[model samples]
Target: MKEFNALVVDPVGLHARPATVAVNAASKFKSEIKLSYKGRSVNMKSIMGVMSLGIPTQSEITISAEGEDAEAAVQTIEEVLKTQKVIA
Candidate 1:
């Protein structure tokens, strides 16, 4: 497993459009991806699961992935976040 920390930078947080982008990218990966906040972890591919975390701007979260493509998946997802300016 690989782990990394990031801060949610989107002014709107992880709701609506941002949430959709996160879940869609997560679903495309074969790795077991998880997004964690305040000790709670959720499956990255589940839109509702991610939204339920109520991630707000400036909130720090941990992302982890395990499986064959874990490293690549994490890197790609991290890039997506940066590209979308969702998290920093």
Candidate 2:
């Protein structure tokens, strides 16, 4: 498994837009991706799961991926987070 933490930068936190962006990218990969915030964890490929976390702005969340494309999946997801200003 590979894991990395990203700080949410968007003013609205990890809301619908970022959740959609993340889930869209995550679903393309074979790797199993999970996102954790505080004490709650959810599947990255599911939009509801991510949005349900209610991650606030400036909060740090850890993303973990495990599988053949874990590294690439993490990199791709990280890029989206950065592009969406959801993570820094």
Per-prediction TM-score to the true structure, in the order listed? 0.92, 0.96
Q: List the residue pairs that clash in candidate 1.
A: none
Model 1: residue 72 alpha-carbon error in angstroms: 0.9
TM-score of 1: 0.92
Provide the lowest-lDDT 10-residue window in model 2.
Answer: 9-18
lDDT of 2 by residue, 1-88 (tens): 9889988888899999778988999999999999999988999999989988999999989999999999999999999899988888
Against the true structure, whose lDDT is highest? 2
**Residue-wise lDDT of candidate 1 within 16-81, one digit each (tens)?**
786778789888989999999999999998988998999989999998999998998888888878
Which ranges of candidate 1 are over 4 A from the true structure? none
Candidate 2's C-alpha lDDT? 0.92
